[model samples]
Target chain A: MSVDLDLIHRYRRSTLTRDELVKVELELQRSPAWRSALNDTVDAHRLGATWAAVEGSLDAPTPSRLERAATRLGAPQHLTRIMGATPNLRRAWMVSAVVLLLFGLAVSNGERETATIALFLSIAPLVPVFGVGLVYGPGADPAHEMATVTPMGGLRLVVLRTLMALLTSLVVVGIAAVLVEERSILIAAWLLPAVALSAATLAVSSFVPIRNAAAGVAAGWLTLVVIWARIADDGVAAFRLPGQLVAAVALAVSVAVIAARRDAFSRAVSTT
Target chain B: MRTEADDRALLARVSRGDRAAFDELYRAHAGWLTARLERRCGDPDLVDLAVQDTFVAVWKSAKKFRSQGDVGAWLWGIAIRRLIDQMRKRRPTPVEANVLFDQVASAEDELFVGGLHGELGESLRSLDPDLARVLVATAVDGLTTREAGQLLGIPQGTVKTRLLRARREARDELARLEGDSR
Candidate 1:
């Protein structure tokens, strides 16, 4: 019935029972001063700048979400750490792995005709290039800028992801190669082309947008294979020693170009 | 108030690997979790690490989250466990007394404690640390007495008693300061 200051304080502290709270609510409605006092008490306990400080700390660098997931799924601790340390590359790795599996399934057991197998292998090496394209540059990864500024930077990140894509593609293709009738030739053809195309894609990416570079390289390779098949009367000629020599030369040149312009990948070119 | 339905929807999206939804959940809970964890440990780095670990766990185990429970409380439980884990790895150095006092004073000022010459802030700073902490947990931090007890490792009744004493002391001090200022 009366305004007890201590009772009001207890009410403000939320230490009151349900009945007591109801009583205090009624009392508070009858007294503006009591309400003001309660507000003042609450204000005095304010955690100034604490929220902003915490929010800033949250923005501090940590492992990427995929890396954390990998760790949770029982990946090797060091491998997870490496994956976590590299941001904006998980999607590329995942896409590369999936592409390899699907491509391997399509070509395994010599189920398809020889022409179909040749065409598939010819295009299969480009799968990682596409994956690499999706990893960097504008319009690809939403976190491209963040990835660019990371301690790993763009060149190392691109290389790491490309290597991952290449390795996963190799393993999948290698397993599928064992199932094919012409295992040695198919492996040789695909392996050299995969490395050459991946390196060329990376090299071109340093100078142009990754998407454009990847598209250009893919189109040129496909056209060359088509032209070679027409002129030589053998579609698999592009997979032979002469073709492998060209690929080896392409790989070397691309590697040299990539090394010379390595700094180009350090800063992202915003296409948007 | 964040509804259980909203939390459930966000968590469901997170379980499906929606990064945006996980980000939304993080923004919603990171502040309060940081505040609560900081109360237990003075080390900012440790608190930050615990917050990070808690959200990472949430992202990984979101599918395990029941749709019917309080998401904030569940997050709190996880944050507390993370704090414990960090403490086990290395004990955090206690915050210096002067630094604590300065923080309380600065926070009071920053909140613009009302009354002539900000008597409320002065009064709050005048209370015993034990009483002030109880008040902060129950009032400012909006924890129930039982929750405050769980956080402070005290009985609920003790939290209630300390909270009462804290308020009484604050009221008397505020009155005295107001009377003096006038």
Candidate 2:
């Protein structure tokens, strides 16, 4: 007998008449395949429906409750220490401070030429690259296994560390830009490259080792800068409109890649 | 049918610590899980605990959820495993077979086994309890074989073998009843 998918659908929805229901039941009794199909349809429909009886028990732990649980269980201390001892943020700050100090000395000594400022800005985005690369990866994180087993594993962890690195680098570099004596356009030129290169590094790191990905990104970016400098007759020409446009497109593509491969970050791969 | 894309999107949001998405997922499947588990164990508290743990596990493992699979089947698999865990922990007093039979027969009397009286029910009652449990979980409860295995704390291959045996025995019993009637 040919099974009517529409009949099974209507029967599951309880839209069948008494006679229709009997007919369906007879068909179920006659054909095991039909019975199986009906069972699947019913199960699928019921599985999606809300059970009012258990609704009261489904509340997730709230922030206050989570805090209380953590305190009672002595879990907060470990998490607090981990957050406090983040080596990435510490190294990021140190690198940023040193870079800013060198730029400050150079500016104060009457050496704030366009080429020098552009060169410094080009290299500034690498601070976050190194910072994020240091924090991520199995080798970098002593608590990598523990963190991966937690609910906040995978993309969430990647986003958090990357955001911290990006923000730290941006703040330090933004301050350094303010100190530069160049035009505002030159001062803002580093922003796009910083975002694009950092995002691209993260996207690449999802598949490759974080350290290798960071190195490749840095090398490719610096090579582009040097080549542009030689070809454009101006050493600072890589920070121009065409470069900024390329950075914007690269940033968009990198973000897409990161989203598509977000789960890869959760895998236990060692960084070289 | 809820689209796979919709469930995948919800799971993606859930992985990101989205409370609203988690709540939506809970609302969607909690009741069905509770009902199926309640039927198995006959203890509301045990069923509730299992349902809660299932959602919690789902929240923690949302990142591992495969987008290509059926979300309901996946959620059902988790719920059954949680139910089994709860069963192992407390071992709720087993309802006697006759009493459980009466309860199920009365509840689903007209809906599932209509017109046949107790033929299907009796066939179910006569099978080995383990095989019967697997059969009910899959055929009656509407869970897939994989899900039934997860719920029963057995391997998928075992679920398949037991299910095939259970179906053969049930069909034989029904045929015998038909022969006797004729």
Candidate 3:
């Protein structure tokens, strides 16, 4: 347990080669008793002056828990930061998404008919659809005008925010559905349609302003569901196999259109 | 725990305002830096203040570290001077002369006091305490005349006079040792 005073002296003078320094550090790590002896040979502490000098610098703000979790899940820090800034994560959108699902669950209570649940599922996606279209849609970010000027490409920034909004909406909706009722079978029915409609909104934004695209897609979905339900004399008609087929087709079309026009989403504030 | 980065990488990150990196560097070096400071200055509180000031200085000026020297030595240089500054500002309780001599007897500072065997150790041990301190502060600790004065709370003129006498005494003792050997 002898301390290497000679080596320590050389170390204090910073005379050790990098290789030698690394070796000593590795050795220090492997042996606690040796580490303690070295500390005995080296350390002491002070309080007030450090408090004065550091002055809260060490208390720098940490990333939000969600952002940190995302990073730990292997997302890069820069991407996580962009995701955290999505406008749709605000309390209003989060609360609305949860509340809308709850409202639908309450309406579907004990009823034997599948009508109300289908109608509710169709409408529940409205919030998320809005979120996806607007989170990255021109006016969502105040700095949208400077979109072209940023080091990050507008499309990449848009995709990250859109993903943030989409993921958050789907998660809250799914949780609310599971927690409130055993209607998961019925609730699962709307899952694909919700994603499809959201993608359609992104795709449509390429041809028109973000606000117009968002409003148009929302209005179009609502009109189709309402008319189809009325014609069938059943609120559940719009969410049946036929409706799911239409939603799937729309989703595929949206993907194709977005892929085709992907190069120009940069000016999506004015044109999709 | 994950394998730690070396001091250079840690310091580079610290200089970039990386708090986590600064934290890692602090954990690695603070213990010994504090121990070394505590040994030189007996006041726990003063030693604590010196250590704090040393790190705060490090955090602010980590970028000044050119790749020229080892991080540990550069840190010690900052720490020792910080302790001296604390000592200058507030006169701490003194280590009893016996306590000071005991450290030498214990061979604790193997590089400095332990090296003082035979003629030098005895000569210093027998010399007047004031003369011995001034001599060690200048010659052993390598402080300048003004720095030794500040550390000992003595005037520079007094430190010079005592250093002169201490040197003559040690020289004479060394000469005697040589004569005896012959």
Off by over 4 Å in 3: A1-61, A107-112, A142-148, A179-184, A270-272, B1-182
Residues A84-115, candidate 2: write the lDDT tens digits. 43543466555655665466547555654866
Which of candidates 1 and 2 is the stronger one according to lDDT? Answer: 2
Best by DockQ: 3
Q: What is the C-alpha lDDT profile of model 3 across A50-80, one tens digit per residue?
A: 4444545445446888889999999999877
Off by over 4 Å in 2: A1-85, A100-112, A268-272, B1-182
* Model 3 docking tier (incorrect/acceptable/medium/high): incorrect
Model 1 TM-score relative to the real fold:
0.46
lDDT of candidate 2 at residue A153, scale 0 to 100: 70
Q: Give the root-mean-square deviation of each candidate in angstroms.
A: 13.4, 19.0, 18.1
Greater-TM-score candidate between 2 and 3: 3
Work out how many backbone clashes candidate 1 has. 0
lDDT for position B92 in model 2: 56
TM-score winner, 1 or 3: 3
The window of 10 residues in a row where model 3 chain A has the poorest summed lDDT is A17-26
Cα error, candidate 1, residue A264 (Å)? 3.7
Instruction: Give the per-residue lDDT digits (tens) of candidate 3, residues B1-182.
Output: 22223777788898998888876777777776665554356676787788777888888899999765567767766877888898878776553511222233223223332333344355565575567666556654557898877767679998998878887887888899899999
